[model samples]
Target chain A: MLSEFDLIKRYFTRERAGRASTVLGVGDDCALLAPTPGMQLAVSTDMLVEDRHFFAGADPRKLGHKCLAVNLSDLAAMGARPLAFTLALALPQADADWLAGFSEGLFALADEYGCELIGGDTTRGPLNICITVFGEIEPGHALRRDAARDGDDIWISGTLGDARLALAGYRNEAWLDAASHEQAGARMHTPTPRVALGRLLAEQKLARAALDISDGLIGDLSHILAASRVGATLDVDALPAGLALQREDQALRRRFTLAGGDDYELCFTAAPAQRAAIEDAGRASATPVTRVGRIEAAPGLRLVDAHGVPLALSLRGWDHFQQ
Target chain B: MLSEFDLIKRYFTRERAGRASTVLGVGDDCALLAPTPGMQLAVSTDMLVEDRHFFAGADPRKLGHKCLAVNLSDLAAMGARPLAFTLALALPQADADWLAGFSEGLFALADEYGCELIGGDTTRGPLNICITVFGEIEPGHALRRDAARDGDDIWISGTLGDARLALAGYRNEAWLDAASHEQAGARMHTPTPRVALGRLLAEQKLARAALDISDGLIGDLSHILAASRVGATLDVDALPAGLALQREDQALRRRFTLAGGDDYELCFTAAPAQRAAIEDAGRASATPVTRVGRIEAAPGLRLVDAHGVPLALSLRGWDHFQQ
Candidate 1:
């Protein structure tokens, strides 16, 4: 077996996207970064574990992509532009093929966003991938969760519930035809990070509060409500469901779209007046944005159908341990 | 059992030092940090896994301290001041007592250094702890491994081999009295990161190249040699052995002192002219500095006795995967 150092050198060290902010990259006690002047650094971390996160034989390439995508999503929610990231990986062994595919998947998305791999650690154990991403944003421009205001429109980028649909298929909770399975699986495996959309929203000052929907729409939206000390009236019928999920029954579609986890779409708030500008920003980034709800002065979330009639649902967001 | 969110809020989030640089800490999608305008951010990450990095049932408190200590040691090696850290933790189950002790231990050290816990993720899985630390250092003053120059004096902070001695005792390869075991175990469990010493050396420009000794002295020092394209003549007999290891036989002591892993002492280089200044830095930091070698023009390490006689020793540094 290759030694730990050899494995890292062969897979991770050889491939890097050089960024000016990275004063020092891997192969040192610490990697030094020089953030652009007058910018605040946005930092987020995420961990993915085998079985608990993905199945035992999940594709290494997709796994790598998803790990970084999740972290970048956090940065996107903060309306920060990707700068660099550090990866800390624990593996059962130094499998050459696995490392090659994983690094390929990782660097592919990283290079797309111009995110550099600054530094990392490798060790032997049950497979776990932890990544901490660094991004830069102008001071006071971050789309903070606490900045949501009354009468702001809640918008979601891209479709939701597909990743959860894929998960349901895996668990045999829902039957999926081959095409639906393939489409949903792709969504689960390689959810796109709305980096450009987020950056555009922040740079153009077109959004208020923003966050990525990982723990279903309603559950994640509640965080913004609590943080901003406000509430929301969600238009459940208007949620943009994945094409595959739309083929399912209405009840199943509602359940998955309303409470399904692992969606990487950004749920952001904007004033009604900025709708045109927000749409322009989305068009510029080439991402789809859907207005699904409205911020309210009340202190509790109220779900509604197309007619503004109240719909009672008791779905909670995903709590890893609680599950 | 506590849910993931509850566990995090109950333990990790409650005890944080309010560093001025942190704009938004735990509970936000991404923590916002305003790094000092003129300084660079030094970043490093480490992942510790059950049974691989530590025994499966190691004390939670010590495990917590050791996890952050190892990362802080990296920052110290770079001559940076700790600013903040993000933790990504995986647990088999939410044991309240364990979480309480772990957070207490983690916060105690963090508060001492004023390093805030900016953000983190908690999940259910086989036990794992990954921490990425961020520190600040003035540009051009970082103690990089590639800065070692020929004719420089090699120095070590405090003693070495005690952690290895403790491991040997655990493995039944060495005999230790109760008191010796306690002392050596403490060294292994709760290492004091030489942050102050490293900062003083950098701020005062007393050192050139430096790295914390984690993978044993010989293995890590060779990295500096390779990076700087210089060689070193190490006085094997001059190495400072841990207090408990001092009673061991000459061969054992030499072997462990030269190639014992888990010693968090700083191995740094400086010119002969700055020896007094380096000593003063050590004194100011309350750390012991011992000169054990000299850099040479040739391109390979040479081991010598106190009388300058050549010593033939075959010792390879610890490689996690190889072990």
Candidate 2:
């Protein structure tokens, strides 16, 4: 079997992008980076574990892509541009084919966003992938959850609930046709990070506060509400649903749309006057934005149906242990 | 049982030291950092898995200290002054006492170095600790393994082999008196990262190449030689051995000094002309400096005894998998 050092050099080492920002890459004790002048560094870390975060025999390529994607999504929520990231990986053994597929998936998305794999650790252990990504943003431009204001319109990008719909298929909680299963599985396995949209909103200063939905819309949005000391009222009918949800019952669809996690879409709030600007920014970035809710002066979140009747959700999201 | 979020909030959150450099830390999607002007960012990552890196029932406090210390050791190897670090931890369950002990150990060392625990992720999984630390260094001042040159005097900070001596006792390969076992065990469990010495050397432009002894002196030194395309002849008699080794036989002592890992001492090389400067820097940092060997023009390493005869040692060092 190849040694840990050999495995890292063979699979993880690649020509780094953003050479000016990354002064040093892999093969060193520490990676050296030079953030652009006058920019603050944005760093976030996320970890994925086997069986808990993924299946035992899940595709390695997709797994790699998803690991980095989750971290980049955090950066997106902060409206930070891509800079570089470090991966700390643990594996059961040295599997060349698995590593080849994994690195390929990781690099493909990283190249797309111009985020380089700066440095990482590989060791003999259970399958665990932890990524710490660093990015840079102009001073005072980072979108934060504490910045939301009452009366601001809340907007969500892209479709939601498909990933959860896919997860349901896996758990045997719900059934879908093979075609729908395939589409939903793709969403569950590989979600796109809305970096461009987030950057545009942040650079334009159109969003008051922003966050990416990882633990479902209601739970994640509650974070923003709590941080900002405000509440929100979501127009449930306006929530975007994927085609996979078209045939589901209203109750099931509402459950999926409101609390289905794994959607890497940005949810942001903007002042009422900034509607035109937000639309312009979305068009420029080629990302669709839907106005799904509004921040309120009240101190708790509420969901209203089309006729203005409130809806109740027993389980807002999956809380790894609490559930 | 506490939720992951509750556990982090209770234990890991502490008042950051370099607040001026941190725009936003903990409780945010991404922690923001303001690097010192014109300085490059130095980053490194290390992971410790239960049973592989530590005993299953090891003291939580010591394990926490060692996890961060290992990463700091890497930064020290590059002569980077640590600024901040992020921890990604996995746990089988949220035991409050364990977290309290772990956080206490981690914060104690972090406070000593002014290295803040900026952010982290805690999840439900097998026990694993991964830390990625960030530091700063002037553009050309960071010591590197590839920069070693022929005729440079090799130096090591502090003693070695005690950690392994403790391991041998645990493995029943050797015997240690009660006092000796306790001392060696502490060394193995909680190592002192040579941050002060490393910073002094880099700031004074003393060391040509440097790295912390991690997987044993011989194995890690091989990395420096292979990277620099140079070799060295070590005076085995000059190799510093911990007090625990004084009672061991010559062969056992030599093996421990050469192949024993877990000594977080800095092994560095400097130009012969800068010997006085190295001495001054070592004095300023209050870290003992020992001259152990000389860099040779040739491309292979050797050990010489007091009489100048070559020593043939069969085992180079421990490889995590090969062993």
Chain A TM-score for each candidate, in the given order?
A: 0.98, 0.98
What CAPRI class is candidate 2? Answer: medium
Docking class of 1: high
Per-model DockQ: 0.90, 0.79
Worst 10 residues of 1 chain A by lDDT: A11-20
In order, the B-chain TM-scores come to 0.99, 0.98
Task: For candidate 2, give the lDDT of residue B221.
Answer: 89
Question: How do the residues B89-207 of candidate 2 rate in per-residue lDDT, one tens digit apiece?
Answer: 99988899999999989988888888898888888899999899999999999889898999999998988899999999999999899988988898899999999999989988889
Computed on alpha carbons, the lDDT of every model, listed in order, comes to: 0.93, 0.89
Which 10-residue window in model 1 chain B sums to the lowest lDDT? Answer: B11-20
lDDT of 2 by residue, A57-110 (tens): 899899989999999999999999999999988888888999999999999999
How well does candidate 1 match the true structure in TM-score terms?
A: 0.99
